[model samples]
Target: MRAVVVRSFGGPEAVEVVDAEVPEPAARQVRIRVAAAALNPVDAGVRAGVFGGAGKQIGLGWDVAGVVDATGVATAWSPGDEVVALDYGMVKPLGSHAEYVVVDADAVAKAPATADAVHAATLPLNALTAAQALDLLELAPGRSLLVTGAAGGVGGYAVQLAAHRGVEVTGLARQDDAELVRALGARHVTEAAPGSVDAVLDAAVLGEPALAWVRDGGTYVGVIPQAAPAPVRGIRTTAVEVSPDGARLAELAALADEGVLTLRVAETYALDDAAKAHARLAEGGVRGRLVLVP
Candidate 1:
């Protein structure tokens, strides 16, 4: 099996594709024949040693859409089951970027019926992060919510999901992205939040500035775990450490299939071009996820 990994930390140049032994699933795990995997910012963090696995080969990739080739005992999945999964970890020996990767069976969900592997590959991580962050905000219907970076992957999903729940979503993005943000169901789109909102989902990691957009006694949730701003004015503050929930992912996949959630692929790279994909991601201005097809 060939997998993307970083043996030493630096820049995109540190990303390497190396041949590795095919991993086998342990109890409650399933081995996926990698069809497609989405390259995420976290992969860049890993490559740059942001998570700190010094001198160790740290695998890349987190979102995978593929077929179940093998499963450990007591798992509900079967061989040949098409699925999507979040291979959750900052550092690992192998990841979903490989030709074959093993993940806990409980993290696997059926792929969206309406999307191909490339598009399905974009779903797990960003959508899960957005959905989980919304869950933390716990805003009721008709309440106002602001989604920073609303044109990006996670923020785009946050806009749609929050809007679908009847929350009045305000999308903060680049001026040129206003149309796209509005199309994603944001009640209002802006380069910045105009007034205080009921809550702010800081997908852009604006930190304190975004927190300031939240009204007193409201909520603020950030995607990065433990990176949330300190609470003030009786407002609740927290960060979502996204976890894999097969059941929750299943609902998200269904939402994608039903058109409640839109899946976007900024570009696709051959598995062997993993490094090139990382370089492109580093360039910024990517509207959707960069997918690696094996």
Candidate 2:
């Protein structure tokens, strides 16, 4: 099997597409014949020496959509079941960028018939993160919510989910990408130069710009780990690290099937072009998720 691996952490060029042994399922785990994998910002962070020795020479990717080829224990999944999953955690390795990847069965959900592998591949990481951030905020319907970097994958989903829950969403993004955010149902789209809002969902990954967004008593959620926003006095600051929940993925799949949510695919690359994908993501301004057809 072929997968991208980093020999040294520095740049996208450090990633190498190498032939490797295909893994088998472990206890309560399953092997997926991956149809596609999506890139997350964390993948770029891990590749650029962001964590120094801890993340060097690692396989970095979390979003995957595929079919079950083998399973260790039967809960609700079996061989050949179409699925999507978040396969990594604080200590777990990322392996979804490969031809076949093993994941804990408890972390995956069946992909809806309404969505193909590409949609499934794009949903796990970003959508899950948005869900958790919203959860942490303890927000409710009719509340005023504001999101920065609202044109990207997670931001797009964040807008829709908040809107679905009946919250009024205001999005901050590029003038060009504002329509994309609005299409996801953001009530207001502003090119406000990344400053000031009611409740802040900071997808820009920058701290200060996001800090300026909220009132003294608002909720602010930052998606990047280690890039914690300052403790704005009188405000609730939440740092969201996405986790794999089989049940939550099922819920997201249901939304997609109902035509209530949409997955935006900005582009697709072959497995070997992982480097270019990384570069594109790092450059910013992409409107949707980028996937690798493996």
TM-scores of all predicted structures: 0.98, 0.93
Candidate 1 lDDT at 180 equals 96
lDDT string, candidate 2, 53-162, tens digits: 56434676788999999888665678889999987743234478989889888899988778789877988888888888888777778887888788888888888888
Write the residue-wise lDDT of candidate 1 on 1-294 in tens digits: 899999999888888899999998999999999999999999999899888989898999999999999998889999999999999999898888999999999899999999999999999999999999999999899999999999999999999999999999999999899999999999888734434799999999999888777888999999889898888888898999999999999999999999999999999999899999999999999999999998
lDDT values, one for every candidate:
0.93, 0.81
Residue 98 in model 1: lDDT? 90
The per-residue C-alpha lDDT of model 1 at residue 207 equals: 90
Query: Which residue window of length 10 is worst by lDDT in model 1?
Result: 187-196
Best by lDDT: 1
Regions of model 2 farther than 4 Å from truth:
54-56, 90-94, 191-198
